[model samples]
Target: MGSLFEELEAREATARKRVEALEAEVAEVSGRLSAAREGLERLRIARETVAEVLAEMTPEKPGVAVDTDRSSAVDSVASAYAGAERHVIGVLTVPNWQPGMGAEVLPRVYRDILEVVTDARGPVRAKQIVPRIGLPAEAGKIEGTRSKLKRLVERGWLDEDTPGMFTPARRRGGASPNSR
Candidate 1:
């Protein structure tokens, strides 16, 4: 009986030591995982910044060859692109609506925009359009949406009744020029 009791005590001591070692390992791994998550978050923010900068950069005469010493021109273009990128990032982080995507989500941005503009008897401004579309009243968001509205007008989907005001193109009694 004395020998058996001693064997059980030795086994309990080994088990306790294993539990302590596992606790130490768990702490180390948790610290590493936390550091990795922070690094990943930093990388994600960097990626978004690069994407915004790229979005604002445009090739001057995309496929055309430069015929002169364009150092000054290149500098100007870079500066302009940087300014545009900052402006866009400061205000709106949203992308413009793509008309080709079929209805898939509830209260779509493009459809809501049309509904807001058409529901009014006349031209609509960004002030009126912003809330209807469910975006925050940020300067960048408002201006970005306004810009999108202008493009839709150029594409024959809507008409600009006046500067910064919008109306549906169909009110003029014709199909969109680009529509099939």
Candidate 2:
């Protein structure tokens, strides 16, 4: 009787493990289903976008000519937007700064780095900035600074004129560290 009871207990434990595994599988299937639903939504959006674009380009009436004026207007708007974007230094607002303090939102090292680069009248290299920013001559520090500068360019805080050369991005109203 004792041996029989032990066998039943072991079987129960095994059953429990099997049930847990099945539950895990169910959860995985649920996640996959969710992802499939999201993909379907994206497909729907894409289809709608293509339909809208086709409608715009196609003539609504059988004999109507494609609207040249509408096409020209679109072109004008695109060029104007591009010109405006190119003229502005960065997309972000230029926060007011106390000459030496830099922007409050930036890290101390970043402010130091920006100050050095902007103080240079023209585009400066990462090598040039490292010393002025007081970073050590180690290769790691130099590379790190270079990466930071690149990121700054991406964030619209700085501009890259040449490979590895950086300059201050102009503010929306033409104000910048140099202008100030």
Candidate 3:
């Protein structure tokens, strides 16, 4: 009877030791998981910041580099965010036209507007362009088209000779074909 009691005590001691070991392992694994999550979060933030900076960049000079100030800032930011996972989101905006650049860079709607203006026999009105671009002939649509036309003109992608009249911008050597 004494031997049976001693055996029960020994088994209880072994079970307690096993439970303690498992608890320590669980704590260690939880700490590792928390560190991994923090690292992943840092990486995500870095990737988003980089995407924004890249989206804001403009193709200024052909062979020459531009925006040295911005470039340096990007470099510092990139180094700080190194080892992050790759996930990117960007916003597209109308870019100021540069020589040797093509219309491909423009967003779809802007390209459509340019195409309509370019195909027109002469200067076109926003109202005329609105329907041609497949928009309803409504006041709101016309106004929106006009705003885009003005933006194109401001970006040097189009020329506005008269009020509410839009045409393709003239080249350096000669006037736009529609201008004549």
What order do you get sorting by lDDT, best first? 3, 2, 1
Candidate 2, which segments miss by more than 4 Å at Cα?
A: 1-102, 172-180
Give the TM-scores of the predictions, in the order they appear.
0.41, 0.39, 0.48
Error of 1 at 180 (Å): 14
Stretches > 4 Å off in candidate 3:
1-92, 173-180
Candidate 1: tens digits of C-alpha lDDT, residues 1-180: 999999999999999999999999999999999999989978875765564444333356342222222454355445546655442222112222235432232125656776788788889898779977887787866875786576566545567867888887653334454332
Pick out the ten consecutive residues of candidate 2 with the lowest summed lDDT. Answer: 86-95
Model 3 accuracy (lDDT, Cα): 0.71
**Full-model lDDT for every candidate:** 0.61, 0.63, 0.71
Stretches > 4 Å off in candidate 1 = 1-107, 171-180
What's the distance in Å from true for residue 75, model 1? Answer: 30
The number of the candidate with the highest lDDT is: 3
Report the lDDT tens digits of candidate 3 across residue range 88-112. 2223245566657789988788899
Output the lDDT of residue 83, model 1.
52
